[model samples]
Target chain A: MIENAKVCLYPKNPGEVVRILEQEGRRALILAGGTTASQVRDPGVTTLVDITRMAPPTDALTHEDGEWFLGCNLRIQQLAAHAGLKQVFCGMLCDAALSVGSRPIRNAVTLGGNAVSVFRWSDPPVALLAMDASFDLVGPERERTLTADRFYSRHPRRILKPAEILKRIRVGVPSGRHGGAFFKFARTAFDLAVVDVAVCLWFDSDICSRARVAIGATRNVPWLSTRAARMLVGKRLEGKSIRAAARAAREETKTADDIRTGREYREQMVEVIVRRTIERAGDNALGV
Target chain B: MDIHVNINGQAVAWRANPGENLLDVLRREGFASVKRGCNQGDCGACTILVDGTAQRACLLLAGQAEGRSLVTVEALGTPAEPHVLQQAVVEHGAVQCGFCTPGMLLSAKALLDENPSPTYADVCAALDGNLCRCTGYKKIIEAVLDASGRLRK
Candidate 1:
């Protein structure tokens, strides 16, 4: 049981939420979708603050200045059904959202929870990391945006101050020719990922302009393989280049033994999945 | 705190602890249809329809259900007048142990409510959360399809 449990507060607005957080201080626990309780080993929480009401009443998905603003309260099921996301984000959001847990769980799990969850199975972060998504944070003091890397760089972290909450996620639509793919290898379709890979590539005529390869469940944090990504720049996305990049990703990735699989097996799966995801993305980008 | 929610279309009030889960509160309120399986979101035994969407009650706090509509398996039908899906389950011999039936029925109901005619893949996706250790899922899928066919007419 939650020791010293207090009343759950439903904040009407961002400012109200901040006020509650500021007043409660360390005792306040922000409950987005409430799925994190089961996974949390010891939730030294006192007060439960429900921020669902703090969400904007309008559309969760909006395009402003070439960037898409995704509300933090948008549930995974809504994200999967989002037509604009499916059209622009290259199905990564849908794939990741659909890949998380089961249909019932997905109905309640919010995109913000997935982004901030230390649980690696919270699938959207890897795909969002590859897509270079940034988070909009609102605190008692001020509001700012943090890149996905900074937001997820530490364990059990969201880069939010005690009274801060993630407001929205900003993802810039990649211009020109580009494609992306998210591949998760798990025991079952509903199970957590043993190894997951997300790859996004931009093609300039015959040469690849840019690439982002992110491997998840391989480390404490989802890691972007800069070496692997750099290997594809200015080179044709062919078998040789893809193989080198995948190998680089495998080399750069850090894995540890877990209940899911062994370290060596995860490393090997990472290489295999990274290669497959890159090839899939390349094929999609080339319209093949 | 005192929380009020619409359960099975009836407004009810109950005093709940600050962090009490909806599943526990529901089971205590005699809604035994909402089972307690893994207590985690992994299992669908505690599945219920919250505002027409299938969700696990185990993960949701009692306070979160305030002023929202909740439908447990009890709302579907009684033994005399079983829901069409329940009738199909019986006709197709879909209940082996019957522990997971409530969740499957609710999930299937949510799916059929939205899309009356669902394909095999759609049915599989809808019932992905509800795990039936018995019946091997073949008869369960067939039962859902049969219910869909019956509902259409």
Candidate 2:
């Protein structure tokens, strides 16, 4: 659909994405995964550099004491398939990856791209946010680390500059009593989410010590329901706490009248999904 | 852009648009077997094996296919001496109207390459992305499983 656009395939690395951006001097588009980028109309665009190989490093998944490192280039598919990471998170990442489009889409769409682009329907942002994920960033102003919350500062409006390149995504993998789960509701088998909920529970026995409930597809970034998480910290997740947390999650979001679902219906569905996912994550603590 | 790609075991060159999907480019170059049904990536009628992995040719940019080994329906043996999968499909009566056969074949080929013995569930999972308006997709699933069994032997 785009005219006068030239694509440069086989970018050697992610840095090349930055270099070409610099060389093109803001006139061209730096395209990685070309899913949404190709669809847009950028009049100044003359070149489109494909960034499939420009993915970040997959060098380490080490654990020192408690901190865990997840490589940025780790494809959403790759993250789902890693047996070690899956064992720790218990299908949290896998659920997110499986929730996206079909096989070929998953095969090419990287985790970093999903996060950097920050589409609300995208899974990584909500799942990673629930687990307290951080990013190792590389930019013109030297390299630094930014938490998922800080990395996504625009609450209701999701937008990012072209110059920022995400190097790696880091998370403190849940250990001991922590467990996580993600649930997405779409119109059909493969479609964007209307409303989704992800839960990460740190329960020592039946008593929940800490918890995080993130609502997705209803907000710009993953809306971490601190009130919902707090309501469950001291109580059990089975009965009253579930109802209260679900209520808090509902109050935290303000949905619009989209074709997917009505504003009232989405708010109601959010409560339902939150309660269900939280209970499901809590059930995992029993290992039953 | 001028690009060279290995098409069905032979190197074929084309002066292509980098933004163009590989499906149109391949079809233009007379690989008639690579069906073009859906311009969108959903329908698997344009599926092809790129670097031994099944991918939607409609979704991939022509420039992205460079340096990759591309296998399309043309590579499979003809009706006179059909590939084992083609034979299985015909025997199982999997082709009806048959707009979706080429992509189905590539999906089957990619799965068989990865798993010589795939269960019925595995076959369904591999072909989930590929859609068919005819044959009810029942016989096609059976054909893939049947081919998997034959290849395993």
Return the top candidate by DockQ.
1
Which predicted model would earn the best lDDT? 1
Task: Name model 1 segments beyond 4 Å from true.
Answer: A1-3, A38-44, A156-158
* Candidate 2 Cα errors over 4 Å, as ranges: A7-9, A54-69, A155-162
The residue-by-residue lDDT of candidate 1 on A113-216, one tens digit each, is 77776576557888888999998888877898888778877753546777777788898988999999999999888888998888989988979998889888
Clash pairs, model 2 backbone: none
lDDT string, candidate 2, A1-288, tens digits: 345656554667666666776677656554445555545556666676666564344433556666667665555656666676776667786788788777766655667767777776787788888877888876555677877767765641233344656767777757678788989888888778988788888977778999888888886667788899989998866779899999998998876877677889889999999999988898776564
For residues B1-153, write the lDDT of model 1, one tens digit per residue: 787889998998888865778888999999998998998887799999999999999998776777789999999999999999999999999999899999999999999999999999999999988988878899999999999999999
Model 2 / residue A139 / CA error / Å: 1.0
Classify candidate 1 by CAPRI docking class. medium
